[model samples]
Target: MIEWFTAVQVIVALLAGLICLVLGFIGKQPNDLTLGSIVLVELLLIAQLVVTIVAPTVGNEPSGSLAEFYIYLISALLLPVAGAFWALIERSRWSTVVLGVVGLAVAVMLYRMGQIWFVQGTP
Candidate 1:
């Protein structure tokens, strides 16, 4: 995985988390802006998944366990979707809080994926 691209994902995820948290604190459900941020993050994750799949064919495999890395990747990809679904169902400020938690988790998982890509024995 590309370091710079992964860093961008991390930053975006964290920012989204912060935004959701702030909105929740202010007693608001997720609005379009928050939903848009989540969508943006999911798009970035899909791009990363494509890169991960193509990189190995181009001889750019991860240094760490590929299985573990893939698990993280798949989990990261699904997180936002689940969170968004829950948020929609709940339709409350707490739903935004759930999204905030999901965003932060995605950020951490992305960072872990980077480590798995570049650092050996990272599992």
Candidate 2:
């Protein structure tokens, strides 16, 4: 649960959200650029997940409840995938809106994960 990496994830999520919202406002469906951005964010999240799992083994366990942290982690990991799938199926501007909303949600979840891991203080 590296704090800086978590911050990066949050930033990326917000950027993706903004991009998607702008595209939606302009009546554009999810395009390669939007989807690619989401994918990049997703990959960062996967790396975060790996670090979260490996950190505990290396004496960096989170202070918060492991179960709660895992819940947030899993949700953060899945949101982009689900949103992308929905966007592909719907093929409308609203699909981009859906992605935008999902991105925002992911950002919030990442922040929560950080609170769970760092703000609570090391155990």
What range of 10 consecutive residues in model 1 has the weakest lDDT sum? 114-123
Q: What's the lDDT for candidate 2?
A: 0.89
lDDT, candidate 1, 1-123, per-residue tens? 888999999999999999998998899998887777888899999999999899999988899988999999899999999989988888899989888888899999999999989886643
| Per-model lDDT | 0.91, 0.89
TM per prediction: 0.95, 0.95
Clashing residue pairs in candidate 1 are: none
Which prediction has the highest lDDT against the true structure?
Answer: 1
Off by over 4 Å in 2: 121-123
The alpha-carbon root-mean-square deviation between model 2 and the true structure, to one decimal in Å, is: 1.6
How does model 1 fare in lDDT?
0.91
TM-score of 2: 0.95
Q: Candidate 2 on 1-123: residue-level lDDT in tens?
A: 888888989999999988998999899988997888888889999999889889999998888888999998998889999999998898999999888888889999999998998777645
| Residue ranges of candidate 1 with Cα displaced over 4 Å | none
